[model samples]
Target: MKKPEVTEQPGGDPPSRRGRPPEPIGEDVGVAHRTWLEPVRDRLVASGLTLDELVCRSGYSKTRLSELLRGKGYYPGWEITYSVVKALDLPPWPLRRLWTAAAREADKNQGWIENRIRAVQPLGPELPPVAHLGLTQIMRGPYTAYARAFLQSENRAQRAVGETFDILWLTWDEAVAVPDTPRHAWQLLRARVMSRAAQQDGHPDLRQAAFATVAQAGIADLAERKTRIDTMADFFDAIARLPQDQMDVIVLRHLCGVRAEAVPGIVGLTPAMTHTLDHHARGALTGLYLRTGTTVTIDTLE
Candidate 1:
């Protein structure tokens, strides 16, 4: 199929003028997340800094930035997005204009991402250690990488199960199952200390219960046996909205059954502070669900 051509205007026609629709501005860019690059490239070109000069301020390698601008290779992250925009020192409106252009270009080429993914032939499932992947791993970025691989291997229903359980449960189980460095020991010790503190605090039980709620929620979220149509989307959407730090609060306290007092030691917060954060998060979610009135049909965990 012939690619659609877009007309490029220095601020005039778009770059291509094929069957594709004109890309939307920044706010309208869909959730694919790397839409910032198109704008980043435009800013670098407009600033007259030359690639070398832009790299000096942005700290990105001039070569890599150039490759991205020329569409030689794709990037998995948008460090460049914020960097180029920041380096330009452009007025906010100017930066916004560039951002809009980039988003349009990115949306136009979105399929290239899928083609790249399908071409990967990594030795089967050499799934990385969860620690290396980090918090956002489950929701976006690397986590999205995991989900794509997972979907390729299994049906949506099974992938959903793995998303809830294998993706998370297995990681935690595996982490605790084997031994690792002093750092890992320290993390475990921290959790124990916090758990003890929660016991000392009268709210220990509440902390434990709150933790359970989050774990169950995550599990339900992952396995997604939810029979209701679109419940999976809502479940995943809700999880996506949760920050890693807050998700940690859920996993540490609920799934692990650690009391509130013990949470701070493992997670770097005070007992009072942890409690506040947890309550606020739950309250916010409840409000979100109520406002959206998104009902999830749940399947009981086996």
Candidate 2:
């Protein structure tokens, strides 16, 4: 394909810049797309390379490169994507994982995905040893439980945790540089979970989970079962109203069954702070139960 002709300025700079500054990636874009697209855009901007230059290096036409960069039209295959990734000097494996996910989200078939990926040569380097170890630790930790409490699906919670680790791996350097690495990592995990969490009055809606509690009660009568469900829903709503730290404490300690000792590490709080938050959250829930005259026995809160 003939590349778009670039007119040279006095200093031999290409006149055509990265076409129209790439359309602003809005919330309408899927998370998978945003995950990879944002980094690619950042790398392009940081590299200070023009669209004409990218076309020359990627060996693709400017129009195709422009559309791919803007995330317009259909999803581009891995061949073109890897070409651009190489041209920008960005890490390949993470982008490959992210791109494959976005492609799947776009409804591309497995056969097509395999074919497209096979067209590109695989890169040699892998996630650093320390980052891999950190990923393993967080995976085995209470993150999935915390995620499951909000997401409510084993598959979704697992995906959220996996994606969080991928993001952490990508930003491992900056994460380690922070004063509190666990806290930084927790924030990333929280963002990923909350983005997909069901919302009620701007908080994560946990009412749906109340059914499980009601089910465990084994109340057969329809009227009693409904009352139990409603009461549990109210309790969950109250839990949702707690301050962020307290709410996290309640969810991790009570809903997720994470042990008191482990709560501090998972939520990135000191032992004292975790205990205080748990205490305050229980007190607040107890007060709500008392005021409403709900006769629910919460063993965990006790």
Candidate 3:
């Protein structure tokens, strides 16, 4: 067969001299695509597939794949990304999100003139744009984990995660417009999950579930175990009574496994403020446990 370059020549008019740079939009477009695809491609190649081998399996010409992996102006579409994902024998989960983000950046770069024109329109409030990426799937597990930690019920946690996704759907466009869309979605999900968990503090069903957890974990045979269970119940109740900020910091930092230093980024506070909240939250928990004559350490909470 002839060289693949002949089969996949980039379709566009000749490069016009915009008098700004040789390839004004090329770098941005290339970087967006390369950011995710390059790593995957390198991994596959290291596993033994050559460029020509990948081209044959994926049905994408070598020239096109090479340019895309190099972060050229032409970002791959979903079809191409899907084909590559299959060829690389990788899951479509994150690759699709990366491709969608890259495609959005590429489209924005190519349509700068149109965007500028749209910017001047006296349009009413803009609706959020729809995200084609698998952002929901990406966030589902983390959101569920967060809810489970905060709410302490698997069923409630799943429902809370679903609700978070529903809210994300409504604000999809706004979330996806940011440079780090996943991080934005995470912050939104965290806030929603925590809010829903907080609302459950007075819920009769949650109270019952807490008792159920204690009963399920503690048996009646041992007096010592029963006393520990009682203390555990008081611990959780005390946690529920804490303020929202303290509760959130405690849950995210300890339960969700978020780093202490990184908690501020998710909670939108300075490092010092995050530390202060953590200190206050621990003190509150300590005070609550002390009233019951049980010495509970912050280390035990973690």
Which candidate leads the pack in lDDT? 2
**Higher TM-score: candidate 1 or 3?**
3
- Cα lDDT computed for each candidate against the true fold: 0.42, 0.79, 0.57
> Which portions of model 3 miss their true places by more than 4 Å?
1-141, 173-221
RMSD of each: 18.0, 5.8, 17.8
Clashing pairs in 3: 30-71, 129-173
lDDT tens digits, residue span 33-117, model 3: 6545645644454445667777899898977766655556444556656666667655454454445555665664536423433
lDDT of 2 by residue, 66-163 (tens): 88887877888999999998887666776788888898898999999999988888688685547657655764558888888788899999888877
Once model 1 is optimally superposed onto the true structure by TM-score, how far is the C-alpha of residue 29 displaced, in angstroms?
Answer: 31
lDDT of 2 at 167: 68
Clash count (model 2, backbone only): 0
- The C-alpha local distance difference test score for the whole of candidate 3 amounts to 0.57
- Clashes by residue pair, model 2: none
Considering lDDT, where higher is better, how would the candidates rank from best to worst?
2, 3, 1
RMSD of 3: 17.8
2 versus 3: better TM-score goes to: 2
Give each model's clash number: 26, 0, 2
Task: Please give the lDDT score at residue 109 for candidate 2.
Answer: 100
